[model samples]
Target: MLRFLDAGESHGRGLCAVLEGLPANFPVNIENINKELERRQKGYGRGGRMKIEKDSVEIISGLSEGKTTGAPMTLLIQNRDYENWRLKSQEETFVSIPRPGHADLTGEYKYATGNLRNSIERSSARETAIRTAVGAVCKEVLKELGVTIRSKVQTLYGLNDTFCDLFDDGLYDLIEKSPMRVLRHQEEFMALVDSAKKNGDSLGGWVYASCEGVMKGLGSFMHYDRRLDGILSGALMSIQGVKQVSIGNPFYIATGAMYHDGITYEDGKIVRTSNHAGGIEGGISNGEQLEVYCYMKPIPSLLLKLPSIDLKTRKNSDSRYERSDVTAVVPLSIVVEHVLAFELLKEILNTFSRDNKEELLAAIEVRKIRIGEIYEKTTDY
Candidate 1:
């Protein structure tokens, strides 16, 4: 199985990750990683920190001559802000008050620390930078195997707009270049964020991902832990400020008549009329476009402070103001794509042993043939 561990504080020296389980001879691209990092930092309403930090990855091990060495891969993303932060006095490092909708105070209690910075540094979404870098690497593997993954921002601070469709991979590049990462209503949404920033509030909204060319039966139904939906949803929920996750049709959209995907035949091939199941049923991919939705809460660091207690003085006070984006849903959609990509990589690795590029492709081809036989059986062929 593919596994990874991330280290380093938010404003510390840098972020580090050690990812293992990739087969040898798979190309690892530094330029791709850097490109994903650049996307993660872009988006409207971002704070000053985005201006200073230009994230790039340094590979310390598990790669040689641009390919994996069949060992654990080490990745590094230095925090440029750490240099300036180091110059501040010790008192400046401490945030006495916890911001509402943050892990600050509760994390402080759990760790029993005097300064909330202890918790703040690690809990900050800054950690996702390295995770995104790792996801870029995983994405390379999936891309080579013919799985195309992409995501789009659906809503911003409840500003209603048409959801971006991921069914067509041709538009993937356009969405990636887009400022708001939406197919429509970019100007209006940015204006809404501009207004929210003027009012010192933050915005949150929905994003969803889709995958094409994914073969059926990557995850298993033998055990609860082996369920693909359970694993994918768990990974999505772990993203900071992501409140909810749903596959295909969410609960509110599901009713007996409108809910289920109906199976059918098209031009001698079995097909699903609607993808209400999101490509996976019975804990396995079903050869349809895989889709999942996520909801992220507003960023907690507002220009105006929320009510809280000052840990230092033990008295009621407003939370300390911190630099933050008025809205981060745009870049967040990118993160969600890679996070989901990593999970998809895990399930693929579980199904195939690819010591080299050719083997991975051959394995995928074989799986598709076998799945075709299953489809024929379903169609009474």
Candidate 2:
């Protein structure tokens, strides 16, 4: 299985990630990974940090002549803002008050420290930049196999009942060009973000991600740990500020007829009449588009600080102000898109298990043929 370990502080020297289990001779592009990092930094509500850091990946190992050597890969993304922070004295950078929705207090309790700066540094969303670079590498692998992943901000400030079609592939172009990553209501979303920024507050929203060209049976139904939906949802929830994840259309209050996808026979193949199940059924890919929805809570580092108690003084005080976005739903859409690429590529590698790129593609093609045969056999009955 593919895996990666990332380390770095928010304003430390830089970010580093060690990725493992990629097949040999796969083409790896540094520019593509840099492009992903650029995408992660864009959006209207972004903070001054984005202005200072031009995020890019530096491949330290595991590639020769632009191809993988079947060894572990090391990636680095240096933080430009770290230079300024390094000038500050240790006492000047200390944090005694913890943010309410952040891991500050709990992290201090876990480490038995009065200072929450250590917690804040690791838990910062800046860490996601390295992960995004890792996923960008995985995306190259997926792109070679004809998989396409896309995402968009479906709602802002908890607004629902919109007419946006989350499943429409045509919206990809519009979403990619829009700063807010919304299919429509761009002005409304921007206004909300501007209003929140003016009020020294933050806003939360929902992001939708989809993947296509995934063949059947990437995950197993026999084992609980191997379920694709569970695995994907867990990976998504691991992202900072992502509070809830829904695979397919989350219809906890609906009947089977209302939520379940119906099957139909089409040209000797079994097809789902609708993709309400989000292309996954029985813990496996059903040869349809995979869809995911994530709800990201407002960032905890609000400019207008919420109430909190000082760790040393035990007196009530407002939270400390930190440089942060008013709303990150747009950049979050990019993060969601690439992160799913990593998970999907991991599952594909686990299922196919080939050490060579050509051999892996061949294995996937054979699986596709097998799926077709199985579909035909099922449809005949």
Candidate 3:
């Protein structure tokens, strides 16, 4: 199975992720990985931590001369802000009251810990940095096989009408240029963010992600656990602050007949009139672009605190506030993109002959031929 285990606290020495199950001989570019890390750090409304930590991945193992050797890959990302936090110590940063909309309360209750700092450190979104590095590595592998994944912020604070389509031409460029990662309403988003900051509040939004060039039948319908949509949904929901996930525009109101895609043929290739199904059917990829949208909640650590009770003092108190983004939905697009990429890579590996890179590519080509033959025979009949 393709998987990774991540460790280290948000403000600890650094973060570490060990990823395994990739095939041998695939090339890796540290620079490309670092570029992805940099992308995750960008976006307006970010906190001072972003300015302090410059994320770059170091490969501790699994590659020989920039190529995979079929061993577990070890990735390390040093926290530049670690030294600053280290001097403060956990006692100094101890938390008595939990933050609202965060794991602090539940985690403290579950673990029976008095200090919420134990929960806060691990539950922080800062851990996504290492996960993003893993996703970047998966992206390189997927790129070699002609797959491309991308994502952008589709809405900010429930303002959806001004967003751009994910498949629009030059959408990526447009998102890169905008601080909010939206194709339109850049000024409005900035203004709202400024206002939220002034009011000591935070914002939430939707991130739309898509993967192109994934072949059909990557997942099996025979098993519920093996369904592609189920797997992808689980992965997306696992991200910090992500509360809702949909394969496509599931929220759109339509009749059963109008909601689904219509199959058609164009230029001797099968196509769909609409992609409302988001490129998946019956828990399997249907040779269409895989599209997903995730709704991330506002950052829990607000300058305007919520009501809570202090564990130490046994008295009513406001929730603890930490340094956090006014809105992280912009960089969240990057995280969503990479998270989907990693899941897709895992699905591809699970479905194909993946002992090595060459074998995996040949298997994919063969699967494509088989699909073509099946379609051709059915069309002829």
| Index of the highest-TM-score prediction | 3
Model 2 compared with the native: what TM-score? Answer: 0.96
Candidate 2, overall lDDT?
0.87
> lDDT score of model 1?
0.85
Model 3 lDDT per residue over 332-371, tens place: 8999888988999999999995879999999999999987
Residue pairs clashing in model 3 are none
**lDDT, residue 217, model 1:** 84
- What candidate 3 gets wrong by more than 4 Å, as runs, is 161-169, 379-381
**Residue-level lDDT tens digits of model 1 in 257-373:** 777789877865887777888898998888888899889998999877678998888999987777888888887888998898898998888888676677877888897787678
Task: For candidate 1, give the lDDT of residue 206.
Answer: 90
Every candidate's lDDT: 0.85, 0.87, 0.89
Q: How well does model 3 score by local distance difference test?
A: 0.89
TM-score of candidate 3 relative to the true fold? 0.97
Give the candidates in order of lDDT, highest first: 3, 2, 1
Model 1 regions more than 4 Å off: 167-173, 251-254, 376-381
Whichever of 2 and 3 has more TM-score, that candidate is: 3
* Residue 103 miss distance in model 3 (angstroms): 1.0
Give the clashing residue pairs of candidate 2, or none. none
- What candidate 2 gets wrong by more than 4 Å, as runs, is 160-170, 251-254, 378-381
